[model samples]
Structures are given as structure tokens and as C-alpha cells.
Target: MPRKPRTSNISRSDYYDITFYLQHYACFHCRKAFKQSFDNQRTQRLCPQCRQPMTNMGTDFKAPAQKEVAQWRKVQSLAQAGIKFFPQWPDGRPGERPDTLAEIPAFLKQVHPPSEGEQMLERRSQEPQRPQTPREGKLSLQGFAPHQTFRLSGKMLITGDGVQVFHNEGWVNAEVSGHGNNPKQPSHLRTFKLVGNKLYYAETVPLDGTLRLRWPAT
Candidate 1:
């Protein structure tokens, strides 16, 4: 019972030079979420089970149970829409997340407006222009300018330069080739070759039934 247990009055931050914050990374496909110390230099985090890139759900994310498919799907949709679970809104209020799948569309619309491609297409449609040739039969590359983005289908968003494809997970390097009528269907299809021998066929027309050809907004 000596005086050997004297406590220091130093603050925690002053004692520990480097503070490490925890961040949650979720793999929706695996229905798993784990925490890792935040590393500013680290760019990508891969799931331990699936080896797929994990979504950074931020510090406030609480993972749903593995059996809760609907809940997981909602979370996945939010992640795909580039929404992260933060503790507080930008205005300092507590975050309010949608509870059901049906409410997600309205919530997303309120938080995130139409994407860049949609706005660009809308603006172009308003402008006076001549009717152009339909791209249903040809493979002309004129519409695909550099740095533009187009929604190839519900599951795929491709860059105009044919360099990358953004799916539910994230953007991946891809090669777009063999543009023409799909052999299996009457619609036009664009072949996309992903990094790991994964081939995807996306319709030239987007899910909204619009074929974007105008330049994207900068």
C-alpha cells in the first residue's frame, strides 16, 4: 500500500499521441459487417470472407442480423446510392433513415436529386435540336465521349470512354466491346468484360427507356 499508484492528471489525447477511430465496413453480399481502425491512407477495404471490396458504412452504422434480408437489401440500396450511415446530419441533427423499402425511393429523392446524367439529358432534351438517327442498328462510337457517364441498364452504369463500370458494389475497370443487337434479344447490347473474367451484357437503352447520347455536364 505504498504511494506507487499515483495517477497522472494528463488528458487522454495528450497521453496517446495518435488517436485511432473505428470505422465499420460492410459486405452486403456476405451480410457481414466489421470494424476497423480508421486509416486515412487506406483507400480500399476488402471483405475477409468474399474478398470483395467492402462499403464504408461509417462509424454510426449498425449491421442488421444476417437473416434479415429485407433490412440488408435496404442497406445495400442506400450504399449503392452513395449514402453512408453517419451519426448526425450535416446540420447537426440526428440522422433519420428510411424504415421500409417503399420509403427508400422518397427518402433518396429528398436527399439526393437526379444524377448528373439525368440532369444533362433533361437539359439537352429541352434544347432545340434536330432529330438524330436511331442507334438501334449501328455501332457508331460518336456518342461515347471521354469523361461522360451513361446508365447501361438497371444494374450497370458505364463510362463513355468504356473504361469503367459502376455496379452495386462499386466502380471497376472494364472493357466495353461488341456493340450491336443482342443475339438473344431484340434490343441492343453492350458487352462488358470485368477484371476477373466476369462478362456482363447491358442493354444500350437504360431502364428508364432513354438512350443518352448528349455530352454529360462537367
Candidate 2:
């Protein structure tokens, strides 16, 4: 008879270690979450806690800590079925459970009391401070500071000579010229208006002839 093939210890050890990682799964019947091995989980769909068939939520998620799990269990106990929350959660589609499982961390942070050190740090971070940069770099406007930046689109005229606009990490010298009696005139920059510290500028290419981009006046 032919000799039977032998299993290598190294391959068996690697397989055991790799398969030991926790996989996140949920049981719709019991409304519970659990961590289990792939082989056992495949064969036994029944939850150890509930002894009911579970819906595989996949292996990409981290299991919540014991404290968080206990706290969430309390919340689940109080939650009413079919009642929408103050802010209704976005649960992609029917049959696919809510992705709100990720929100547990934020919920925990909000409801749980922080240590004295954490409270002190949070308070200190909230205090306001003066602007560190000089006023020369910012654009001055009617309702904004000289250090603020605002976007310019449509016909605008910049009165100040040697006026530099911030672009691509460094300041670039800008020269404005008129559209020469055209019905649709180009945008002008009369004064710098800063809406917020950070702004996004995106250009859209539409099939129609007309081109338009708009920014808030306030």
C-alpha cells in the first residue's frame, strides 16, 4: 500500500494561529454580536449565547470591549422596536442591518464621564487665541478680517496694485483684464472676502456652452 501523506507541524501551527483572530458576527434572532472561529462559525450558524442561527456580518470589524458591550446591551434593552431615533440612522437597504455598529465608540465617549485629566485637557483646548500670521498675507473685505481668505469668481475688480492671490501653497501674482464688451463678462476680484479658513474650488465642464461657478456672498 502507498504511504499516507503526513501533515507538517509548521503549516498546522500557522493555520491555527491565523484562524484564531476574532471575527465579528451578529444573530438577528437574538439581536446579539459575537466572535468565533471561521470553521466553527461556518458549520454552526447557531450563536453560543442565543443558540440561534446568526447572520454573518463579516470579519473586517473589531469587537467592542467588554465595558462598551455591556453599555450597548443596556441601550439595546431600552430601545423600542420600529421607533425612529431623533436623528434616524442610515441603514443602507432592507435586509442589510444598520452600519451604526461603528457609532458605538462615539456613543460611549459622549455618555461616559471622562477622567479629571481628560476634562482639563478638553477645557484648555477650547480656549481661543490670537491669529499667529501677519495681516499682509490675508485678503481684506467688508465683513472679514485682513488675514482671511475668500474665493473670487465672476466679474470682480482688484483695486490694490501688486495684489497677490494665494494658490497652490505659494502666492502667485494676478493680473485682471476685461472681456472687451462681451455680453458675458469674466469674473473680477475687487476685494478679498474670507468665508472660512479653508475653501474648495472645483471646476465643472458641462456639455452646454454656458459655464458658471458660484460662491456665497456672505
Candidate 3:
């Protein structure tokens, strides 16, 4: 056999570099946080206790104590508004998030402007309620097909194929799969994981009139 090259001759770059760092995934509803390791920050995780989707608070996030209900509420508001507690803002500015609840409104205004969907909702709220026609009763996914994507309440997106879901931004993948109606209750749609042919990591979304699910034009 031919002599092999010495291991010392190999450079560090020659090997595949997979560096994992611990990031915080928080469940605002549960008021708990968990640390998970991933090579990047875009990974979505679920709450172990509630099995509901959790928000990725990034590496620099320092979670408030569980007993701090008011602070947790503030954090929850920020997270739901698509704000991540990264070391820097999306615009590359150093993070200077509000420490007090009173300052949060102004800080959020400076950072995140009202999205189009939000503005529409606000305008609709200001408008007087009109009588509902037959077509405006309840939203339905009756004719939806596989691989087609639909937006949920302007915040989450789900494919009709039920294989993938994205929360807030499309690039951030929410790993839970399986989107369909609960067999026993057809009034609600559910996103879940199927493990060993049984339901796991499930979250139910009620098909109430308050939530709007629409297929966006491609």
C-alpha cells in the first residue's frame, strides 16, 4: 500500500466545520425558556411543556424570570410582533431595547413600522360594521391544493401539503408539520407532527371569524 499523508499536514479548513451554539427558544404562554443548540439562528423550536411553537430569542437574549408576569408580557408582545432579541437590530444598529414597559411602545415604533396587514386591520376596525353577506360568513380551505401556500392571520404561512410552516418571515422555518382539520372537530385546523402514526407536538388553530386565512397571489 502507498504511504498516506500525515494527519498534521491537514489544515483545519480541510474539515467540515459545523459549529453549534446555544440559543434561547421561549414560550410566552408558558413563561418558560429552553436552550437549544443549532449552527444558525433561524431554527424554530417548540415548547417542551405546551408543545406549542416557541420563538427564537437569539443567542444574546436574556429571559426574564418566570415570576415576572408583566415583563414576560412585554417580551411576548415584542416576540409576537416579529422582534427577536438579537445583539443587534435588523438594520445593524446595536440593540437598545426598552427596559421598562412604558418605553416599549416608543422603541417599537422606532424599530418596526406597522405592516400593511396591520394597517388594513386598523382601518377595518375604524370602519362601521356592516351586515355580513352569505359569502362573508366564515373563511374556508375547501378548494386548497397541495404545495399551495396560505397566510394565517398575516403572521404565519402554511403550505396545503402540510410539510412546512413559516412564522412571521418566510425564511424562518417552523419545523412542525402536518396541517389539517382534527378528524373529530372539523371546525379547527391543526399543525402537528406525526410520530409513529400518532399525533405529536400539536397546536390547534380555531377557525374563528377573527382569524383570516387567504392564499396570496403568486
lDDT string for model 3 (56-175, tens) is 776667889999988888887777667765544366442676787777787787787789998799899999987442221123333234333333434333323232232333311122
How well does candidate 2 score on lDDT at residue 169?
49
**Predicted model with the maximum lDDT:** 1
Error of 3 at 127 (Å): 15
Supply the TM-score for candidate 3. 0.40
Error of 1 at 71 (Å): 1.0
How do the residues 37-130 of candidate 1 rate in per-residue lDDT, one tens digit apiece? 7655656788999989888776678999999999999989988887776545366432888987778988998888889998899899999986
Which regions of candidate 3 deviate over 4 angstroms?
1-19, 39-44, 89-94, 113-218
Native-referenced Cα lDDT, model 2:
0.41
Candidate 1 Cα misplacement greater than 4 A, ranges: 1-19, 89-94, 115-218
Backbone clash pairs for candidate 1 read none
TM-score of each: 0.42, 0.21, 0.40
Candidates, ranked, lDDT = 1, 3, 2
Q: What is the lDDT of residue 6 in candidate 3?
A: 69
Candidate 2 clash pair list? 154-187, 154-188, 155-187, 155-188, 156-187, 156-188, 156-189, 157-189, 157-190
Predicted structure with the largest TM-score when compared to the true one: 1
| Candidate 2 positional error at 103, Å | 15
Model 2, which residues run further than 4 Å from truth?
A: 1-18, 62-218
True-vs-predicted CA distance for residue 52, candidate 1, Å: 1.4
